[model samples]
Each structure stands twice: as structure tokens, then as C-alpha cells.
Target: MDFSLSDEQRAIQDMAAKFAEREIAPHVAAYDREERFPLEIYAKMGPLGLTGGVIPEKFGGTGMDHVTYALVIMELARHCPALAGAASWASGVAGVSVLRFGSEELKQKYLVPLAQGKVPAAIALTEPHTGSDVASMRTRVIRTDEGYILRGNKIWVSMIKSCGWMIAFGTLDPALGRKGVCAFVVEPQWPGVTTVPFKNKVGFRPMETGEVAFDDVHVPASHLIGQEGEGFRVAMCSVENGRLGVAARSCGMLRGCLEEALDYIPSRQTFGEPIGNRQLIQSKITDMVVWHETARLLTLKLASLKDQGHRARQEASMAKMYASDVLMRGAEHAMQIHGAYACSDDFAVGRFWRDAKFMQVIEGTNEIHRWLIAEFALGYRR
Candidate 1:
């Protein structure tokens, strides 16, 4: 029942927390207002050795471990979930995939710069027609003389505007179902690649969601990750790791919302007395603490399983579901304590409310995750 973090994990968390307060807190609201990606920050993070924390040193990364990475993500997200979303998409999701599957040349070309924060990458699996049902994607890639010709549309691509490379998935042979899908690295400078910007998202505005269209975009066979027809496995692997990142982010959001509510309760006055002294406010704050702790515990459990090299598919789903649900609950309670002021931009609670609502929708919606968990609990699907 010991519940202490290792020295490395604690150091990573503390560094992330301090960096977020110093670098992220000041511009978060402005970034949300402008709906612009924080493009210049990575240049600064490169010299600070923050970008490549978990990547192996061979690939020009510090090569720590999963739990440390998850902890760092949580600490950063507590300050600016938007910035965290963008960076995690690159350094967390897409970055992890490259480390797992890329060829040595691919590693030298893409992974090194990515880990060093010199280049940004994106995972391009979700399309306009498919999200959680990723196996049904319609994008097609055909074998050519030297490589593959890519043609499809990927929508809701987080950080597309900022990414220099994309790890994209498409069906090479449709008859094999999910087995036919293959993934390849496509540079943004490649011919026939175009991007359409998204604006005014309900939350995570500075992350820069967009649609990427591949019109006869050609990539060399050397860019293929592992082998033909292996994209589905690669995608699933990245997502299993990604579930940990999402759970961590959601848990941090809950903690941030609770932190705000606790601080405001005592300092804010109602009925000529501090709100913290009132029993009603105290009850609301208590519920927030409960939700925050529940989410944090789930995050830690998932991280431990991942660190042990277990598959973690079911554990990841459970952690993502519970943590995201708790994030929503904490946001709701935080807003309730503020009354009317919660709806205003002047207070940070409003942003947390919107962000938490989106968390339930993103990273495989809670509905889909429940089905996944149920299949395992039932001893296999009926």
C-alpha cells in the first residue's frame, strides 16, 4: 500500500509543474482567444531538454520510462490543457509510435528531431467517417513502383498546422479488413498534401485541429514503419499507450479544477462570511476532492501496468473512462461553487468545464470504452 513516487518521477513532475506555471499559464487564455498554436515554444523547449524526456538516448532522447512521461504530462496539463494536448500529440502519441516501430533510417530521420523538439509529428488515423470505429476507414494507399500513393482525408487532426511529419494510416488491400491497413510517414512538403484549418473549438483552441487531404501524395517504401499490413497493430499499440496519456490529462484537469475551487471557497465571501466556512460550499469542495483522488488513483494504476510492459489494453480503457468521467464531475462542482461567475471568461472554471466535457468525447468516448471493458469482464465477447 505504499504510495510514494520514485525520485525520478517526482523530479519530472516538479519540473513540469514549474515549467507550466512559468511558460504556459501566462499565455493560455490569450492562445484560447486567438485560436492560434503556440508555435514558438518548442524552439525554447529544445534547449531545455524537456521535449525528449522519455525517448531513448540512441534516438537523441533522454530515454526515461512511461510512468515518468505520464506524470510530466499531468503536471503540464494542469496549467494548460490546450498546450498539453498539442505537445502530447507530438511528443506523447506520435512520438511513442515512432520509437516503437520506425526503421533505423526512419528513426534517424524523423524520431531524432521529434524527440529533440526540432520537428513535430502527428498520428493520422482518424478520418471524417471513422473515429472509435477506426477499422472501417475508407482511405486507400496503393503500391507503386518505388513506394505507395496515398489518397484520403483525415479530419480532426490535432496540431496538423504545426506538424512537419505525419504517421498516416490507409488501406493497402481492403479485402483483409483491419489487417490490410498500413502506416507510412508523409512529410508535409510532399506534393499534393493540403490542410484545412478548424476554428472556434469548444475547448483546446490553441491546439489547432484541422483536416489533412492527401491527393496522390507519394511516399517512398522506405518510410513504411514495419511491414505492409501492420498499421492496425501499430495504431492499437500507440492508442494503448495514448490511453495512459489521456487518463493522466483528465486526472490533472480534475486536480486543477479542485485546486481552483478550494482556493476560491475560503477567499470568496458569501452572506457576509467566507464561503469556506459554510457547510454547503464545504460539501461541494469535498465532492471535488473525492473525484480528483479517484481519477488520480486510476491514472497511477494504468501507468504502473504500462511500466511493467503488460498489454494494458483493458486497464487503459478503464483508466481513461473513470478519469475522464471524474474530470467532468470535478469541473461541474468547481463551477457550482462559483455560481454565476463560473460562466464568465474572467474565471478559469469555465474553461475547465468546457475542456472536461470534451475529454469525455475524445480518446475513445466513454461509451465506446465501456463496451471494450464489458467484453473483457464478460470473459470475451458474446
Candidate 2:
């Protein structure tokens, strides 16, 4: 019945808020304009323990709980969702898999550096031909005496060049379907591993997304995470946790939309009076407020459920689906309230609007999430 953030969680939230204001807010516009990743920001974050919020102290992390981790992401995304997205990708989504299933040697090699933010990491699960269809991935990993040879192409991996390692999934035999897949922590600089940047993205521009191709990339047996044939489970674990992260980011965007509208309305004059005086303008502001609070609660609920060691697949889907839809709709309403000003780059509303749409597609598409929720409700899926 406790709905309030614990004292420790509040402290972490405040710290992240301060970090966002001082580090993220000022440079966000320039970074987005140039489509540049803020490497220096993450460097600063590493020293502040922001990079290791979910990592255990033994692994050089803060050992923070998932709820507190969600709070930190909320603050970071409030200023810049792209920055938050990149940070979550490195610290939580990619690092969590290694912590949960990687061997000690693999953790020392990859997880430790990731916890310290000495380098970045990414998960490569999306292929050019396969997105939602995990069983149909064309990427293949063949057995080799040395270890395994990875040969495949991964598209839309965020910050590919910047990451030191990739937690990639490939199938041993496509015929075996999901059971045949395996997860490997492959070094990005290995021979035959090449990447090409994707430019002109509609949103999330501050993060450098790219396509990576592995032509007989060599991976040692030590690099494998979890047991063989466990890649599907490993990827799903990361993804399930990742749903909460995306929800947190969506909550932040929703809050940002509300704050922007509130700030803009009073200063904007129409018909010899401030727009805030108009009932129609007030309605938009009220809607933004509602979405912000609703999404925030759903995100925290999902995080709390996760912290309790409960099965949260259905809850995570609901949170991600509802929050993403709220963000997209909230952004549009905020844009409409801004009138013609929203179209200009001089304001952040346009950027927020574009990023909100992208949020709906990442982590998992809203369509997939809808199906998942429907299945759960109908007792057709566990």
C-alpha cells in the first residue's frame, strides 16, 4: 500500500534531477541538432554512480533497486529522452544480461567496464529481415573449434561504433527456431566486424544508431552468455526489463510536454489576453497533466512489481503500451497548443513530439504490446 518513493529513492531522484539540469538540459539542443552522441555526459555520469544504478556494488555499481533506477531514468529523460535512452541501453538493458547470465570471466571482461562506464555496450537482436519475428532471424552462429563464428547483419543497433561490446543473438540452426539461438558478448573491434552509421533519423538523433555486419566474426567460448540454446530466454529477460526503462522514458517525455505547455501558454498572448485564459488552451494543459500523472504511476508500478521478483510481463506490456501512447498523444496535443511555434526548431516541443513517436516503436512496437496484453487477458498466454 506504500505509494511514496523511499528516502533513498528520492535521493537518487534528486541526484539525477540535478545531473539532468546541469549536464543534459543545456547541451541537448545542440546534440540533437548535430545528431551527436554526448560521450562527455556519460563520462560525467560514470563518476556520479548514475551509470551503475542497477549494478551491484561488487561489480563497481551502486546496487540500486529497480524502482530507484526508474526514478533516475525519469529525471534524465525529462531533459533529453535520447540521452536517457542511450544511458539505459548501456547500463541496464545490456549490462543486466551479463550480470544475470554471464560467467565471471565474461563479467570481468564486459560487465565491469560497463558498470564503470569505461565503455558503452549494446544488444544486437534486430536483423534487417527480422524484427518482431525472433524465430525467423537470419543471423547464424556456427560451431568452431576456437569457439564460434558469428556471421550476420544487425540493423538499428544504437551507438554501434561507440560500444565496446555487443550482446548479440544468432541461431546455431534456424530449423530449431528459438531454441537454437545463442547469445554472445562479441568485441566490436574484432576482425570482420564492420558497422555503418544510420543518419537522418526522425528522432533519437543524439544516439548514433547503426547497422553492423559480422563476416565470420570470431567469438571465444568464454564470451557466450548463459548456456547454449538459452539465447532466446536471455534476450527476453533483457527485453522485459527494458520495457520498464522505456516506460520510464515515456513518463519523462509526458512530464516534459506538460511543463512545456504550462510554460508556453501563460507567455503566449491571443485576443488581447494570455492563452492560459482561454478554456480551450486550458483543456490541452489539463490533458497533458493527466497523461503525465497516469504514465508516471504506471511506470512506477511496473518497476515496483519488478523489484518484488514477480512475473511482470503483462504489467510491463501494459505500462509500456499505455505510456508510449500517452507520450505520442500528449506530444501532439502540446504541439497543437503551441500552434505554429511547434514547427520551428527554436523550441524543443517539435523535438519532443518527434521523439515520442519513436518511443512507440522501440523496446517493442505498440502493436505487439497490445497483442501481448490481449493474450494475457484472454488466458491464452502466461
Candidate 3:
């Protein structure tokens, strides 16, 4: 099988790499320290088609393939995962969901603006009590003659403050379980919607995270995505895209750790010799290299499968689980190699370490993925 990137993909990758180095790298530390979302950077990305690579050209995006989109995310993430994450959330999860399930009128009204980066998009699925158990969400929705009335609370809603619209999932009836769930597009400026931003996050500090409360918010009938009782399917479909983005970002973090360690080993000396000469150090570097390549390959494979129009749920879980695990391990090794300097803000490895740990938790935790992978392997799931 061919494993090489096409010429167009390579060019896109190079362009994204240059853009990240020029536009994102310099501001990483400041953004992290200030806990500020870089709206200006996203403004720049809008014109470059970086924020909407997965969206169709008719929707004001580049209409790029999934593999190319993955490459762009990887390059952007190499310098700043948070920036990459915001872009991914917009294009991959929120945008894709709208495009896949929304009515034509909804697409024209919301998806176009989102694709153009005229507005940001947010998804509210995880509640205060439910993290990975999306079907158990406590948010309640009632059908009305005009539309739907939603009332509930959601935590860890990313980009809530800046989002023009949010995709929120709620249950029509508590007794019906997953079958009762429904998805709606809610305008954040509505009368009953309120948000409180979280601060001092250990990782992804630059991206906004918050809790949202909807108090009988009135949503028009046109805002409902897909048919009623299809919210579970909508959430699961969007999660595959989220997992792919997470895997790509994890691979990029792994590459950053490898590069950081390699750069340090040659300059650091101990007992009158460079640490690069030590077999243990060499072994760590070797493992880092292997992990980075392996994670990247798995991520690309998943992308390719998606591009081929396959469901590929198992592949998404595997790539997301393995790549995130690799990123965590690679960050730890890089920090160990850097020693005391890693704890200091002077080195980027510390940030990578902090961010790496979060990757294992988002887009479905590694623990859940482990169970899923096993179930898939044993023919318990298909």
C-alpha cells in the first residue's frame, strides 16, 4: 500500500507548518500565561482556509479531504494544540454535524457563517454528572407548538462565550433512555441562556471552557437537527470526527516532545560528556521516534478510511487511544530528559506534558476506548 502524501497534501502541510511557526509559535507562551483566546489568530486563519478545511467550498471553506485536514491540524498543533483544537472543533465536529444532518435552511443560516469563521461554534454534550455517558445526560427538552423548550445545565462547554451558536443534546423523556434524546441548535444570546467561564485550567489555557445553563430556552422548529430521537446518533457521528482531531493533535504533541528531547540531548553535558552519548538517552529518543511515527500513521489511516466513506468507528477509537497514550509517554520522557528545566516555563516540554494528559481524557477517555477496543476485537461490537 502507498504510504506517501500526495503533492497537494504535501503543499498544504508545508503551508500549515510555515503558518504555525510564523503566526502561532511566538504567541504560545503569552496566550498560555494570560489564559486568553487568540481571536486575532482565528481571524487570520479564516482568510487562509485553515479554520474550515473540512467544510465544503460552497459553504465558504476549502473543501479539502480528511487526510489533508489531518495534516493541517498536525502542523498547527505542532506549535499550539489549543489553536488547532479550536479550529478542529469548528470544522470537524460542529461544522460536520450541521452539514451531515441539518436542513438546507439551517445550513445556509448557520453552517455558512461558521465555515467562513464569521462566528465560532460550540457543542454542549457533557453535563456536570455525565462525561462519557452521553446518553445519560440530564438536560431536558420539551416539545412545544412553536418549537422546543430546553432547560438544563452543561459543563465543559468549550468556546461558549464566543460561539455564535451551540449544538446541545437533551432528553425528551427521562424514561426512554437514548431513544428519547434530541439535538438542537441554540443561540447563545437567547434570553434564557447563561454561561460562566472556567479559569486557571491546567491545560489548553488559551481556549475558553465553561458551564452553560439553559432555562426554558425557546428554540424554533427549524433549529432541530435531524429527526427527533436521533440525537444519540448525531453525537456518536460527531465524536468520530472529534477523535480524529484529537489523534492528529496527539501525534503533533508527540513530535514536539521528540524534537525537544533531541535538541536538548546534544547540548546537555554530564560528567564531561554529552547526554546524547548515553545508551539510555538514545533508547528514549528511539522510542519517541517510533511512537511519533506510529501514532501519525494510525491517525492518517483513520483519515484515509473516512475519506473513503467508511464508518471506521473502531479505527477512530484505536487511533485516538494509542496516539493519546503515546503523547503522554513522549511528554514524560521529554520532561525527564530536560530534567529541572522541564518544570520551568522556559521550556515548552512542560506545556506539552500538561496538554498531553488532557488528550487522554477528552473525545472519550482512554479507559472507555480500551473497553471499546476490546469489545470490537472480541466481536461483541461491530
Which of the numbered candidates is closest to the native, going by highest lDDT? 3
Ranking by TM-score: 3, 2, 1
Q: Residue-wise lDDT of candidate 2 within 149-251, one digit each (tens)?
A: 9999999888886888888899999999999999999888999889887889998887788899999998999888898889988888766579988999999
lDDT of each structure?
Answer: 0.80, 0.86, 0.88
Which residue pairs collide in model 3, if any? none
lDDT of 2 at 196: 82
* lDDT for 11 (candidate 2): 86
In model 3, what lDDT does residue 214 have? 94
Residue-wise lDDT of candidate 1 within 216-308, one digit each (tens)?
Answer: 999899988878998888777777667887888888888888888877776688779898888888887888788778777777777777667
Q: Model 1: what TM-score?
A: 0.95
The 10-residue segment of model 1 with minimum total lDDT is: 83-92
TM-score of each: 0.95, 0.97, 0.98
Each candidate's clash count: 0, 0, 0
For candidate 3, the per-residue lDDT at 279 reads 91
Query: Candidate 2, TM-score vs. the true structure?
Result: 0.97
Better candidate by TM-score, 1 or 2: 2
lDDT tens digits by residue: candidate 3, 276-307: 99999888899999999999999999999988
